[model samples]
Target: MSATTPSKLEKMLKAGHQAVTSECGPPRGSDAEAIKEKARMIKDHVDAINITDNQTSVTRLCSLAACIHLKLAGLDPILQMVTRDRNRIAIQSDILGAASFDIHNILCLSGDHQSFGDCAAGQNVHDLDSMQLIQTVRHMRDEGKFLGGEDIKRPPSMFVGAAANPFADPYEIRVPRLAKKVAAGVEFIQTQCIFNLDKFERWMGEARDRGLLEKVYILAGLTPLKSAGMAKYMKNRVPGMDVPDEVVARIAGVPKEKQAEEGIKMCIEAIQRLKEVPGVAGFHVMAIEWEEKVPEIVEGGGLYPRPKLD
Candidate 1:
């Protein structure tokens, strides 16, 4: 709970205000302008922007580097660290490096399997799972010591986070899984894109029952379906993602030229509804490649002009 310097997103949540966060995947190449353009588009509209760590296991500019770029560009960045690509040494080293850049918000992820990325034959080095990664960072921050127990001259203080998927299979187990993350010292959780509100609410209900909601912030994930094809793709292709049939049907009902508009409208409506759900702290909008639409969606969801940090 104590950070050497709290991130903008941490400050917003601590102020007891509803917060809005978004994600920005780093480009495949080292194009700072491409990163800056995307960051600038959504900076004013969100409390923090998540720099994905080679999202989908594909090669990309390092998330920590991209985060520093965003910080330099006047935006708060959440540096996502995945375990699939790094061993404990590299992970911890990167955490220290990221902190040096004033990137204080960290999201620990297990990452997508290599099969999904360009490196199907690549070797994975999940020396630690997501839960262990959370614990590792928390230990480094709170104890000011590395996993090897050497004292750190200066610890990396951070607002720690982890992802969740309420719609994933064995649905009943999701709540307990989240509880474990909390126990591992996750301060907040951003879930996978949700189309099944009923399911998300139920997940929240379970979280509430277990008193997990009170322990950490919960930011529900949502990605506006840009087209019926996108909807179908998520429902069929994306693992651990659940796009309800009704959502697909609604998008399908819309005319081809207007589907994008309809998709945004759907997201707005979902935001309005989720705001009223108990234990729902805020939202994490993952617009994917449609970064430009973030401003509209945030404004439409009535979360613009993110609360000022005191």
Candidate 2:
């Protein structure tokens, strides 16, 4: 369905233009100024700034508040709603509240398991999983009804997006998952940081073959490695993250001081290559904490001078 909100991200995708999105984590403390600073740093580089929700199951300034900061900073904010923390009623209410703030783009996620976070004892609120959250958002926006089936006097007009990991194991399930998200009414997808292009490409090829490409926008995910240590951590420690040995070696082969530069170069190359892929609608650059390098990567990928939609 066409987006019912004023979203440049949606406008670009619907216009068949490549989108460049990036991430910004809300500080654990009440640091609204920090949020605005990060926004100004990468504001011109991305189509939308994704404000993560208690990412990794850790508590932080809430995503909704951070999105308000982003909007005030003159940047488009994508509010991430994870079902791991809130039940259906709260999620729907937050969606309405977000729309009231003129925040329209929403990315739904099941979020990381609580075990990995600092608060392991937190309740596992799976009242609505990511899939169900997507359906709920669509229902509220398209049907003008809340998840509880109550009519919304003025439903939110939101541009919906979701996340995926083409590199995740049980690899065959990737494309099928993509299909399911599209069927559930996700307008775009942001995949996990990709280091294994072969696996990602194969997944894309299968998705293309299945004709899913035409139905939804797929933004290939990219994250520049800060060091050999970071690469190793992602490969061996992060769940469902696929970082190839060659990637680790390449970063390690470089001098410790230069590893960051090497990682950035690798990210640039991936962006360039994915631009030619059949199903890639754009790129979602998850720069980790390295927001300073987003513009360099976007420019290096030849996506600078972000498109202006009338």
Estimate candidate 2's RMSD in Å: 1.1
TM-score of candidate 1 relative to the true fold: 0.98
Q: Stretches of candidate 1 above 4 Å error? A: 1-5
C-alpha lDDT of all candidate models, in order: 0.91, 0.91
| Candidate 2 local lDDT, 85-106, one digit each (tens) | 9988799999998988889799
lDDT of 1 by residue, 1-310 (tens): 3334568788888778788999999999988888889989998889999999999989999999999999888788999999999999999999999888878899999999999999999999999999999999999999999999999977997899999999988877899999989999999999999899999998999899999988989999999988999999999999988888999999999899999999999999999999999888899999989999999999999887777775
How much does candidate 2 score in TM-score? 0.98
Backbone clash pairs for candidate 1 read: none
User: What is the alpha-carbon lDDT of model 2 when measured against the actual structure?
Assistant: 0.91
